[model samples]
Target: MGIFQPLNTPIRDWQGQRVWIVGASSGIGAALARALAARGAWVALSARRREALEEVASACKGETRVEPMDATRPEDFERVRERLLAAWGRLDLVVFNAGTYQPLRAAELTPAVVRGILDTNLLGVMDGVAACVPLFTRQGRGAMALVGSVAGYGGLPKATVYGPGKAALINFAETLYLDLAPVGVSVFLVSPGFVATPLTAQNDFAMPALMSPDAAAEAMLAGFARGDFEIHFPRRFTLVLKLLRFLPRRFYFALIHRLTGL
Candidate 1:
């Protein structure tokens, strides 16, 4: 790999590709399923909501299979993976995108809610990765994309528990890339700014550089085409967060306070 080159193999062609998305009921996941299917990829949609997954599949253009499963359950993911492999023979890519966000400050923190954040946002994805690693290693070629958040890049006020969960994903993805890349596996870390989805609808404060789910899906497609290790978008918003990480802690905290007014 060159110094300035992409870290993974470029996935420019989607024709006949097989993709499994763990959170495909609505928001960016649904939009991504539609986008990839339109581009001739066979998409498998997974989520707890079967009705919503069916709705998403109804709109997809190419082959789509609805595989509903709770991400936090290792057995659920294991069962679904077996079904998918039996049907498709091999999965080209799997995206762990199931997550939730709750607006909580220091005072509002509760053990149950904190556990909820940790379970869904962090543990769920980890289980999916654990379930797939052996399969991918055996296949000799596979890819995975973990959906992270810009909130993970640094701390924010309301994200209290949510922020920590996503921060863990960024680190997990980085480490997974190091281990998996040598074994013919491609790992992509997808970070997005506030996209107008049900997940972000709970926010009371004005969000910066907010884009739609469709737009977010398009950005992922572009990133996959370019073979980027970290697929973050809207660049205008995410790039600023990327730069903010370089600042000293005092300045960084002050800047966050000023930007968020929290």
Candidate 2:
């Protein structure tokens, strides 16, 4: 890759594109499905909720397939990958949007909760990557998107387990890109700001720069069209987090404590 080269291929046309989106039962995942389908893309929706995925599929235009699979189960991801490959013969893009977030103080963390977050957020994405990379290698082309969070950019008061899980994803996505990009594959990391969804409904803090899921979906598509490696949105919020990443640990901790009062 050249110094000024785009990190990935810019996907300007969605018409007839085949996109498999995991965790598409609701929220940004569902919205992205609808947006892509509207643009004439064939969308395969997967989530743990069979009925919910079906409901989402009903509203999506164009050809749609629904698969219910638990993210924590690697076998489930493999099975869905096989089904989608058999059905479409080629998957242009695969987006892993499934994640969980629970606000917890450090003391409130437990073994079960820690493992649960790691399994669903970090390991789940790794498993999905493993399932898709071989097929992508065989085809010599395919794109992947991993939906991370601003929480992953730095340590926070209430993000304890959830923050670490997402932080791992940030690392994982970068590593995947290094290994996969040379094979003619594109890997994107999506770190969204506060979005009004069932997931954000769990956050008690006054969320700054919160955007709608529909808006988030739009931002994501725009990022793909631009071939951006890191598609972070609501820049008013995310840019600040990005800048804070370079802060010294002591000052960073002080600022976070002062802002969050945790």
Candidate 3:
């Protein structure tokens, strides 16, 4: 491991690689699946909608498996994992990208609202990682990519529940990397800036540097190829957010309020 070397093994080749994407039915997950399949990876698509998963699978150019399951269910993860292992013998990469979001303000705070976001964005992600950690550790050769957001970097308006969940996920990915890297299991944290997807369509405010889902998928693949631990983009937007993380609390808060006008 040199100063300039990549943190994880560069995944430049995808031919015959077995990959399971938990949120592969749409958005970045669907785009990634299609891209990887085009590269000849055997992709397994999983989400609550069987029909949606099938639709994405149909669009994929290479080998694909449709495994519909709920992200919030631990049993679903376990079940899917066993099925994948049985079919592929081993999983070279597993991506936990399933998430849900809702714009929330302080005035709209409620337990159900908070729990709904946390269940999919935080708790479900943790549960999925837990299911894979042991298998990856035992195999001593695997990769896990966790899809997070720039919102995790700092607070902003209308992200009361979403922000905290992603913040926790970012921390979780970092901690997972610390424990798993030495064992040959790579953990990648994907922090994307605003990307145009069904998830972001709900936002009423103007989205800066909003990229298409396909572009986001391309960025992620490029990151994996570079073996970057934290893959964030587009740089024009994410760099500013990264800088904000270093500012003093008072200044950071003030700056965010001014920029977002929230």
Candidate 4:
């Protein structure tokens, strides 16, 4: 491959592609489902709410399968994987986008709160990817996209629990890419900045570079077409955060405190 070549095969043709999105009930996942369906991809939508999943499936233009289940449960992932494999024969792409967040500070931390966020955001994604790894490796061709957050790029004041989970997820995606890329399986980490979604609706602080779910989906599609390994959007915002990672700890902490006022 050339030095400037895409890291993975560019997915420009969506016709008849079989895709499974874990958090497709609403937000970015739902938007992506609709976008892909319009391009003729067969989508399978999964989430905890059957009704919501059905609602999204109904809005899709092409074939769609609704697989409602909790992201926290590994059994749920296994069952859904089996169902999709049985029905579609093979999956061309699977996006582990299920995640939950709560604005938390160090003093406000509780076991329940910590577990709730980690179960869905970190452990859920790990297990879901585990379920699909074997199949993707066996098939020797497939794409796995993990929807993480730019917040994972570094520490922040209010994101006590949420930040850690996303940080772990980013690390997980890196390791997965290293292991899977040579095997012909593509691993993509989607680091989205403040996207308007039910999850972000809980934020008490002002979000920078806020984008609609549709806009976020469009950015993701563009990234996929370019075959970028890390598909981060609203570059004006994410690039600043990426740059912050290189600052000295004292400078970074002081800057973050000044910026967030938390």
Candidate 5:
């Protein structure tokens, strides 16, 4: 048998499920909303940009609601929560995909950059959890899918602040799963390899195993269908990273230097 069963529970039906996707203004979040809506899921889109959210919502086939707000602000989540509660009465799935990324090295590190990454990537996810946990616990069942990164698996060149923040998220999702799984709530840590999105477009180096946003979104839904806890994609790329994660520290550092020349 596989570690957590090859297929946990196939989500073959998506009719009438209310899914709230934060950061749906663009990138993977936008792609996910499009994919879910195609499958008949009613999606509530949230992001700081109302126009972007509305654009995505308008393109969807199923019923879509635009709830724009900043992920970094706690009060914004509170407002969105009220709207979701009033509209759907309950949320079946919450996807925390609101995040920002900037390539930084030790040479150019700044307190502002560090704090900015932590605030949006780490603290923002926590805020989403704080808002959703009570609702999920009250309902006795719900699911959370957080957008982490393969970059989180280990230290990478040009990812000074982004890497550590995502590492925290990976651990956070695992801890959430341990605590929430027993109560029927599922937690997923979605780690994507190099995907072509607005976020990664700023990268200077060649991105290996690069996939489109739509492809990444498809893999996520496929993983969700199987009720996977860690949903990573483009196995050709992610499998090697998974193996590298198990390497000894000395070997890991040496291999990273050899591969990335950083």
Candidate 6:
């Protein structure tokens, strides 16, 4: 009915869908898992903390499987994949929501912080893709959703390390979409402005247009129903960020510095 009609065939029904979420221990991932399960999807939860995963899984409606694993580790991804295939036989969707973040300014830049952010945010997403691609290829149908950020749209103050990681992920998702969509697989890059979560709890400044994790989950599901490739939320904030991406480099830098006082 629109430009987005049938991007990868709208997922109108959730019943019996085998969905795996890699960062379901908390925040958006946990909320999404709960929402999908309520709609009759069998959700498999994964995270480094088994206790946290269990806590989320226990609240889910349908059969919820807990598969704890460190997203940054290749062995962990492989192990989780093997177990998922064995349990579900086939996966309908894989949401790569596992990520780490820290307020990193130029003055506070450190090698360890950069490495940790990149490993978890960028490389970790690649690991998920690597593990799931083979299975999806075999089945000839599946979907992958990556959690990027509005910060990735432009360079922001105090986002020295985190912004680059998300930027890389956004670019990676675009490339993956072009490569995988022809083969009957779907790729979605999700960008949320600021959601109230453990990850953003450390922020000192007020988060404009902050939303609850449940709201974020609802927006994601709405995006899936429309079969859109880029799932962004809180139009009041993300829309501005999207517009800024079109400004000239010099003007963009000046405006950002003036706005953020960086």
What's the TM-score of every candidate structure? Answer: 0.98, 0.98, 0.99, 0.98, 0.96, 0.97
lDDT of 1 by residue, 1-262 (tens): 7898889998999999999999999999999999999999999999999999999999999799999899889999899999999999998999999998899999999999999888989999999999999999999998999999999988899999999899999999999999999998999999999999998999999998899999999999999999999999999999999999999999999999998889
For candidate 5, lDDT tens digit of each residue in 1-262? 3676732345657888899999899989999999999999999999999999889988898789999899999999989989988998889999999999999989999988899889999999999999999888889988888999999999998999999999999999989988887777889889999988899999988888999989999999889888887899899999999999899999999999988877
Residues 121-188, candidate 3, lDDT per residue (tens digit)?
99999999999999999999999999999999988899999998999998999999899999999999
lDDT against the true structure, each candidate: 0.94, 0.92, 0.94, 0.94, 0.90, 0.92
Measured over all alpha carbons after superposition, the RMSD of each candidate to the real structure, in angstroms, is: 0.8, 0.9, 0.7, 0.8, 1.7, 1.4
| Residues 1-262, model 2: lDDT tens digits | 7878789998889999999999899899999999999999999999899999999999999899998999999999889988987898899999999988888998898999999888888899999999999999999998999999999999988899988889888999999999989999999999998999998899878988989999999999999998999999999889998898799998888999888877
Preferred candidate (TM-score higher): 2 or 3: 3
| Location of the lowest summed lDDT over 10 successive residues in candidate 4 | 1-10
Stretches of candidate 1 off by over 4 Å are none
Error of 5 at 102 (Å): 0.6
TM-score of candidate 5 on Cα atoms, chains taken together: 0.96
Off by over 4 Å in 4: none
Worst 10 residues of 1 by lDDT: 1-10
- Clashes found in each candidate (C-alpha, N, C closer than 3 A): 0, 0, 0, 0, 0, 0
How close to the true structure is residue 209 of candidate 1, measured as C-alpha lDDT? 87
Error of 4 at 17 (Å): 0.4
Per-residue lDDT of model 6, residues 151-262, tens digit only: 8999999999999899998999999988999899999999998999999998988788999999999999999998888999998899999899899999999999888777
Judge candidate 1 at residue 6 and give its lDDT: 84
Instruction: Please give the TM-score that candidate 2 achieves against the real structure.
Output: 0.98
Candidate 5 clashing pairs, residues 3+ apart or interchain: none
Question: Any idea what lDDT model 3 has?
Answer: 0.94
